[model samples]
Target chain A: MSVLLDPFAYSFMVRGFWVATLIGVTCGLLSCFVILKGWSLLGDALSHAVVPGVVVSHLMAWPLVVGAFISGMLAAVGIGGLRKLSGLKGDTSIGIMFTAFFAVGMLLISAFPSMLSLTTILFGNLLGIAPHDALQLLVISLFCIGVIALRWKDLLLFTFDEQQTIGQGLSVRGLQLLMLALIALVAVAALQAVGAILVMAMLITPGATAFLLTRRFPAMLLYAALLGGGLAFGGVYLSYFLDVSAGGVVVLLQFIVFFPILLCSPRGMGWLCSARGGVR
Target chain B: MRTPSLRGLALTANNGSIAVDIQHLSVGYSNGVIALDDVSAQLPSGAICAVLGANGGGKSTLCKALMGIQRPHRGSVRLFGGAVNRMLKRNTIAYVPQSDDIDWDFPVSVQDVVMMGRQGQMNWLRIPSRDDKRRVAQSLERVGMQAVARRQIGELSGGQKKRVFIARALAQHARLMLLDEPFTGVDMTTENDLLDILREERNAGTTIMVVTHNLSSVPDYSDQVMMLNRRVIACGPTAHTFTATHLGNTFGGVVNELLKVTGAVAGEGNVAMSRSQLPEYPQ
Candidate 1:
């Protein structure tokens, strides 16, 4: 027990846990919408899109997050533009834009070797998060949560049927843009804890895991946040003892939690399992 | 004629209201195909207009144009005797799109889906009040879906999904309702229930425009018929417009052949006879 609890004695470990919990909670809540809207790929796209922004920001001496958010939103816009102009489906557009931005980020790194470390950008530096960076993560998480709370019904309805939302005199376009912006902000905030690639797992897996556990959306949201925070806490503790990367461990732990629930999902194998009284 | 009930009287306090007035409405897609070409029609309050056409005959295009979801290339659509945007801002229209358009996998309960209709009435940032909850519950009860109110939308059958969407329209309390193919794939019981609900809405003076290929029940369910083949081929009372000639013009002789195949004479009483006999139309 002392060995397990030893990591919390350090200040950096405490801060890392805090940031991880915040990212987990916010990303988990937002991921329900992400899964519902068939935008699982969008999370992947926006996270990769931030790489170019981080590169540009490093070159210009600007805040890395500010640069990440701008580029993330730009990627979303680029996907939308390609959808409109090239008549491509949303998934195809996402695939095109993310790869292009990721390539640009790679090129920038190879050219300006001293500007920023590729591994640090691709894989987050959780323990090295400064107090200001932690504060920034907290603010972004709050903004995303607040907007979701205040406009729950509007967001829910818009995701279900956009045309009906417009018919009822709601701003469907505005809500869509707002959702995209929130995704971008959350992606930027998650940059320091999980990096761009693995943040996709944090964004989608927790919500998906909770979805199998509950029928009600609000309950699902709560379950996802708790599950996410718990997993983050557990992964941090294990990473310290195992001497492994916290970001990778957190994501790996999420999958470790997800696959079993998926197999025993109510609509999946749980039906047979329940009849046989095999697994609860 | 059915007597207007007291609730109907309160709903139609503004009687003789013109709900939709369109003139020279032309709409085209980016692919340069003109979906609607110079179509014009006016429907009054308490009227049910059944928009009929073959596939790709601008039936959905006209509905979208009327809802202001699509821009008109040429003319105008006036709802509630005002601009489409102005009327929309006033929450005057409720739309039930086809089931194919909805994301059935969305994580919302049947009751929650119905509650979305109240968004037009409630101001932004204000949570649902007691009245909103009451209205949503009443709407669910009206659709006979109160039993499954807690079930996820994906759990419902095809017919039940149609009822849920209709329940949403009922909850909106809008003056005009536009339904795109509400009867498609619905069971007989669900269809009859939907027609009864539509009649109650009409008796309450709500303007209804239902886009459907189901011509058999057109005369039985709707007060007027607007036949379309990329433009207004015929628009008038169902008694005068459900003729062999008009249907031929709209469906391009396939309907005439279909009537022959089904062995139903396309004339007076054609609407009722077609309802019972014609299966080739296959709405």
Candidate 2:
């Protein structure tokens, strides 16, 4: 029992656990929209695109979250613009924009070697998070979750049927930009919890798992949030005992939960037997 | 710009009778291809207008223009004497798009989809009211799809999917309804049932514009016909305008072959043939 409670005794561990869970819940909520809109590559692009912004912030002493958000949003807008202007496919646009931003980050880091640590940016230092950083993550997570809750129906309609949304006098462009902005904001908030490298997994896995588990969107959302929060708590708690990386373990735990659900959920491979048996 | 006198004449010409009024509308793609060119039409309220054309004959583009999805490079669209966007915001317009435009794999229930029609009437947060729920149920029942209201949209068959979309339009209580290819994949029975529903709506004073390449059913159902080939080849009452010359001009070479295959005479006043005798237009 003491061994189980040991991690909670440490202040940093408690802070880390709360921050990870908040990020997990927020990402999980946003992930439903991301998955339904087929924007997994956009999530990945936004996450990596924040790297140069972090480096620039460290050099100029700006707020890291602000720089990261602006950077991610810029990448998103650039991808949109490139797709529109060049008639390039969506994946190609995303690939070109994110790689360019990430490479610039790599170049900046090498040129100013002592400024920022690559390892810390790629794999987050959750245990070493400052109080100010935790507060930033909290505020961002709450804001994102609030926006999603308030406009969920409109967002869902826009994703499901863009033409109807437009015909109903809703701003399809506004909803699209709102989705990209939310993704950027979530990517920024998650940057502190899971870092740039694994943020995409945190955004996609929970929603995808929920998708396999349920047919209704609202149920999918509820399941995703619960699964995300539970996985984060479990990862943080187990990582303290295992002495493994908390962020790494959190992402791994998502996959660990994902595969079993994929194999057993009604929408997945399990449907084969259930469908066949019912037919018989 | 038109002079004020001409504008007044245009306004009084349509008065409150027109459901859709487009004047010299032209829409072009970014790649310099014109989708609609100098298209003009004024359809009256409480009528079924069949927009007939070949593939790429600007049928979908006209629908989008009416729905304010595609911006016209020139001219204007007015619905019921108001701007298109303004009428849309009043919840007076509903659109049933082609099934191919929707993500069938989306995790939305049929009832939830129908409820989307009430979004404009809901509060800012879009929570459905009791009245909204009642309307959704009524709309689903109208389409004979109330039994599957709880089912996911992806679980529905093609005909059921089309009915669900039609139910969504009905739930909107829209004064003007636009449907793109509402009968592409439907069976003959379902198609007839859908046409009956449209007739009912028309009787209820709803203006319906149906965009379809299927030509056989137009003369029977449509009160007005707008034959388009990037421009309006003919636009008037169905009895006067749905002639073989207009169809041949709208579909280009395809109508000649279709006339031969169907063994229907291409002369004036003999173009109205039964669906069984006419082959489906080559798309």
Candidate 3:
């Protein structure tokens, strides 16, 4: 009990826990859309592409988030434009753009050398998150949650059937742009919780895990949020006890939880067994 | 501009009876290949139009253009005397794109999928009201899918999937419905059931345009036939318009051979109905 409660007693641990949980919920919600739309690579692409933005903004005294948002959105739009203009498939476009952006980020970091620690940028320094950053995450998390809650049906329609959305006179393009913007915002908000390299885990693994567990969309979302928040909070506590990297532990724990669920979940391999048993 | 004005005139000249009006419509891909070229047609309300052509005949493109899913390079499409977007906002047009174009693996219930049809009629926040749920249920029941309303969409059979989409269009209560290949992959019973539903809707004064390759059933299922090969080859009543000449024009030289084979197979009564056996037209 002491080991369990000891981490919460520290202020930084409390802030770290809150940030992780908030980011878990946000990323958890987004994971469903990302996995459903097969945007996992795009999420990874945008996450890494924002590193140079963070470095340049810190150097120029601008809000790091503004620069991060611009770069992330630029990466997303660039991937889409490249795919459309060059007639390349989505994965190829993602590969070309994300690698280019990531290389640029690596070059910028080496050139500057003073723009934050590479380890901290790649693998987030969750233990050192300031209250201001935590507050920012909270606000962004709330906004994302609010938007999803208010326009869930519209978003679902747009995501599920884009042609029907356009046929129904809905703004599919606007919804797509909004989704890209949200991805950037959530990526920036999650940067301190999980960093760029492993942020894709939080943005995809949770929803994928929940998808295997639940059959309905709302239930999938609910399960994802709960699973993500619970596992993330648990990872934070474990990292404190083990004195290991918090982001690494969080992402590792998520994957650890994912594998077993992938096999046993009713929507997963278990489905095969049930089908053979003549039970659906 | 001239085309739109002529379409408007035709709309009034037809005594406001035209449900879909396409004037000089042309759609092209980025590779400079034209999908639809200078195609024009005016279809009346309460009629079933079957768009028949070999694969790559721009049938889907014509449907997409009518639904405003694809932008036309030169020409205009009007639905019931209004622009496509405006008519769509009024919930006057419902479209069922090809089932292959749909993401069937999406995590949604049949009920929820049908409810999406009501989105165009809902308020900005787009919450499904009680009436919307009732209508969705009614639509599902009409399509014989009420029992499986709670089932995940992915769990449905191909025919059931098609019916669910048709139910979505039914839920919209749109004045004009565009269905692309709704009969593909469906069982015979499901096809008959869908034809019944379509006929019922037509009796209620709804305009329906179905993109299909099953030419044999055109006379039975559709009131009008529009044979197309990148452009209109023939357009008129089903019995008169689906002539061998038009089919040959739409499908090229092989269609004449197909007609001879079809005549012999018609007596044997085991004719293969697969579109794969049909002759492929050169693009």
Candidate 4:
């Protein structure tokens, strides 16, 4: 208790709390869309794409968020364009392009030997968050959440039955593009709190875990947010106490919770076990 | 003539007037092999219409064209008085695709699936209010799935699943229901129920079109039957459309045998059928 109090007393630790909480909440909420669309790979791709931007920003002493956002969105557009023009399927094209971008990001990092906190980008250095990163995350999370709240039903329909939505005159492509843009923003926001390697876990794991337990879209979103928040809070605390990396631990924590549900979940167990089980 | 019931378009079905008007219509893959070649036709509204043909007859392509799901290389589709651009005015239009096209294992409740129809009726950026919910409930009742509304869509039987989709179309207040193949995998009772629903909707002023290979139901369910073997062989009243001559033209020598194949019309999964089964028509 005393040690926890001591950390809170420090301004930097306070900022870390604000920043991690924002990442956890936002990643939790936004991940529902990712999970539903089975676009979990997208989170990994977008996060990797931002690395080159992060490196360039670090070299120029510019803000990392700007680089991350621009690079992430670019990767999304590039992936879409390549899929369309190349006549390859979406997953294959996105996978090939984003992985190459990630490789480029890695090459950039290796070239910059004096780069600050490379491991921090992976495991996240919540202890060293500046007041600005924390504030920026807060503002961005609010913006994403606000937009999600306003169009929850439409987004849900688009993710689940996009063809049907298009048939009914909804702009399925427009909504999907908008979602990809939002995903880019989310990837950037979560980058510092969970690092590139584990950022996708944050974006997909919680929503997937929650999806096993709920049927309605609203319930899934809410529960995904809570589950994500819980994983972040739990992982952070457990890692601090156990003296390990929080991001990796959080990813593990998510799977730990999901595995049990996967065994017993009405929809999940059947899917995982290859039995025709009822959906929740 | 179909009744204009429940705030939807019935295509003014009586006069054999063209419900779908298209000219110089052509559709093809991105690789650029044309499926439809400037086909022109006017399907009068209200009666049940079928688009029948051999494997490469472009029957399905024609259906895709009418719904605006596919682009016509050089033609237009007028749903009512307006061109395809006015397709939005037919907000009540409903589509029932083949059975296997849907992933039954998908996690969706019966009611949640049906409520998707209400999205079009509700204003932009608004949730379904009491009226919408009432209509949804009424639709479930009509489809006899009210008790199973909370059940996941995957849990239903094949026939039940089709019924649920039809109920969803009903929830849309659709006056123009385009069913790709509603009878596949369904029991006779389910088939009859669907036919009756179509009749009820028609009497209440709904226009319907079905693309199918099942020949038996045509006489009982459809008022108009259009045969195609990559081209419109014959189209007119049900009696005229059902002659052995038209059946032989559309199915070749296997018309009777094809009927026993079960689950072949608009086959997306176990029930899918395509032009691959037919003899080569030399390009």
Candidate 5:
């Protein structure tokens, strides 16, 4: 308890709290869109796709988030374009693109082994976050949420049916590109707070859990945001006490929370399984 | 700049002005597989136009072109005598794709699905207004989906799910409604009710185009019919062009072979009933 309080007393802890809060709220929102569209793999792909950018940035001592955003957007374009052109399924394309991107990133790391260590890459350090990085996170978080808030219905319609939306005269291609851009922004914003591996958990788990528990779109988003924020905050405190990896603890807690909902929710996997069994 | 105006002409019982005017429209996949070629048609407003064809015909592709989902390699499509610009597409045209295209496990409710239609009308940041909610309810009632408005869309039966999508399209109050196989998985009553709602929309001056395989009902119900097989094989009144000659010509030889194969498998009859195989086209 005393050690946990020690981190909060410093300015870094306050900034860390804000970063987690924003990541939770923002990631939660995007996660709902991803999960609903059956694009959870996209969340994973976007996170891993940022590896090249992160690796190169760290290698050159350049800004990490900038590299991550560029790489993530490129991954989105590559994956989406290939799927459209080849008519292969979304997951297969995402898998192909991310594995290749991640492998290239890893090769880059191997080539410049001394530039970055594992801890900074896999799980971010709160102490190492400059005040400037924290501020950037805040601005990016606000901007991403604003865009989401603005295009809520358009995004929902486009996710549901690109054809229907296009018929209505909306620019289906434009909305898709905008959504991918936002998704890229989200992946980059989360890099410093939760790192590449755990960011997906933040983006997907909360939304999936909320989807299980609710039917209304607005309520689902609200539940996801709260779930995300709580897990992120709780994970930090848990790590403080356990002296373990903060991001790992956070995502584990998310799954831990998500399990009960999956089982107990009226529309959850558990209920679905039970109904399917009875029918059989 | 791309539209033609031919209103107020005593135009052979055409009923209303052209809702969908396409001239020399051609569509093909990137692989160069042609879907439509030099297809020209005018779907009059206030008419139930049934697009009829065998599998892999251009029925759905024609719908896509008219709805702006895909652009024609040649020619142009005009809706309501105006060139279709990006901004007006949302309000002027409403589309319903096949039900099977959706993931049944997606976590959205019937009302949420219906409300998506309003996204075209509302600003991105603003919440749906009172009028939007009322329109949603009205549309649900139109499709008899009001009872399951709160239910998850995935939980609905195939027929009920189609009704929900119909309700969504209705909520948009679109000038032209294009439905691709709305009758596919639905029961007879649901199909009747759907046709009734479309008729009501047509009565209220909305042009309705439907792509369907349920050939028995097309002649009796549709005001006009367009028979397609990668091209405009024929287009006219349901009663006239729906003859066996046109159908055999429209479907080509491959379909006749399929009918013979199915006849042997099902043991329905020996002659294979050319009339049954033809599947009476819409007018």
Candidate 6:
């Protein structure tokens, strides 16, 4: 029992746990929309795109969160513009935009190596998270979650049928822009805990796991939130005993939990097993 | 004529009041392809107007124009003697899009899909009131799909999917319903059921516009037919306007083969030809 409770006794561990859980919940809620809209790549793109923002913020002495968010939004808008103007497919536009942004970040880092640590930006240092940074994460998580809750139905309808949503007098374009902004915000919020390299997994895995477990959207949302928050909590706890990277452990646990459910859940590949026995 | 209900506004059943008025509407793509050019038509309230044309004949463009989706370079569209945008703002227009427009694999229930029709009436947060729930139930019951209201949308058959969308339109209590290729994947019996439902709605003083390439059932369901080939070829009562000349003009070479297969080209006899007997027209 003492071993189990040992991690919480440390202030840094408690802070890390709260930050991880917050990111998990926020990313989990947004992930449902992401996967449903087939914007999984967009999540990845926005995360990596924030690298330049972080670097630029360090040079300009501005808030990293503001820079990251502005960079993410710029990447999103740039991708959209490329897709529209160049007649390029969605994946191609996303690929071109994110890579360019990441390259710029790398170039800036090399030009001024003393500005920021690439290792920290690439892979987060959750244990060393500052108090102010944790508070920022808390505020961002609350904001993202609040926006999603307020516009849940509109977003669902827009994702399900964009044309019909427009006919119903809802602004599909506005909803799309709102979703892109939310993705950027969530990516920024998640950056400090998971880092740019692994934030995509944080944004995708929970919702995907929930998708295989339920047939209703509301149920999917609930299950995803539970899975994301619960797995993140467990991952942080296990990381203390394992003495491993908390973000890496969290992402690994997500996949580990996902596969078993994917193979065993009724909505997943369980039908394959049942069919083999001629029971289905 | 059926008496217009209290829900019906100044628009009366078959009273010859124009429900949709399109004047010289022209829509063009940026690629220099003209989708619609100088199109004009007036459809009466409390009737089903079948907009028949070949693929790319601007049938879809017209639907988009009426729904206020595609902007027209020339001319204007009015619904029930008012601007299209105004009518849309009033929640007076409901659209049933083509099958390709929806993500059928989405994890949404039939009840939830129907409830979406009540979005405009709901509060800012889109919380469904008791009345919204009641209307959704009533709409599903009207379409004989109440039994599957809780089922996931993807679990439904093609006909059931169409019925769910129709139920959604009904839940909106829309004055005008626009259906794009509603009969595309549905079977014969389901098609008939859908037509019956449309007729019932027309009787209840709702104007319906059905955009279809399927020619066999046009006369059976539509009170008026607007044969279009990028522009209106002919527009009038189905009995007089759904003739071989207009069809040949709208469909070009394809209608010659169709006319040869089914001698019953105009009037009620058009229904005599079974769906399979008709020659396959290029979509």
| CAPRI-style docking class of model 3 based on DockQ | medium
> Interface RMSD of the predictions, in order shown?
2.8, 2.3, 1.7, 2.7, 3.0, 2.0
Candidate 1 docking: what grade?
A: acceptable
What DockQ results do all the predictions give, each relative to the true complex? 0.48, 0.62, 0.64, 0.40, 0.51, 0.55
Best by DockQ: 3
Ranking by TM-score: 2, 1, 6, 3, 5, 4
lDDT of 1 at B141: 93
Error of 4 at A113 (Å): 5.4
Per-model lDDT: 0.83, 0.86, 0.81, 0.73, 0.76, 0.85
Q: Model 6 off-target regions past 4 Å?
A: A275-280, B1-14, B261-283
Worst 10 residues of 1 chain A by lDDT: A271-280
lDDT of model 5 at position A59:
67
- Residue range A148-177, candidate 1, lDDT tens digits: 888877887777788778778888778889
Alpha-carbon error at B269 in model 5, in Å?
A: 22
Q: Is candidate 2 or candidate 6 better by lDDT?
A: 2
Candidate 6, residue A270: Cα displacement in angstroms equals 1.7
How well does each candidate superpose onto the true structure, as a TM-score? 0.93, 0.93, 0.91, 0.85, 0.86, 0.91
lDDT of 4 by residue, A53-143 (tens): 7777788877787787778888888998898788888889889988887777778778887895668666677666677767778888899
TM-score of chain A of each: 0.94, 0.96, 0.94, 0.89, 0.89, 0.96
Regions of candidate 4 where Cα sits further than 4 Å from its true position:
A1-7, A56-65, A110-123, A270-280, B1-13, B53-60, B89-92, B228-230, B256-283
Chain A TM-score of prediction number 6: 0.96
Candidate 1 lDDT by residue in tens digits, B1-283 = 5422323333434456677898999998877899999999877678788899999999888878877789999999999789987788788888998999987767788988888888867867747789989988999999999999999898899999999989999998898899999988889899999989998888777889989887757767777778899989888666566677778778877777887777767554334233554445644
lDDT of 6 by residue, B92-190 (tens): 788998877888778999999999999878899899999999999999998899899999888899999999999999999888999999999898888
* Candidate 5 chain A: worst-modelled 10 consecutive residues by lDDT: A271-280
How do the residues B104-198 of candidate 2 rate in per-residue lDDT, one tens digit apiece? 77899999999999997898989889999999999999999989999988888989999999999999998989999998889887798899899
Write model 3 residue lDDT over A18-52, tens digit each, in one string: 88988888889888888988888888888888887
Clashes of each: 0, 0, 0, 13, 9, 0
TM-score of chain A of 5: 0.89
As a whole number from 0 to 100, the lDDT of residue B260 in candidate 1 is 73
Taking the tens digit of each residue's C-alpha lDDT, what string does model 2 give over A81-104?
999898888999999999999999
| Candidate structures ordered by lDDT, highest first | 2, 6, 1, 3, 5, 4
In model 1, the Cα lDDT at residue A10 comes to 95
Candidates 2 and 6 compared by DockQ, better number: 2
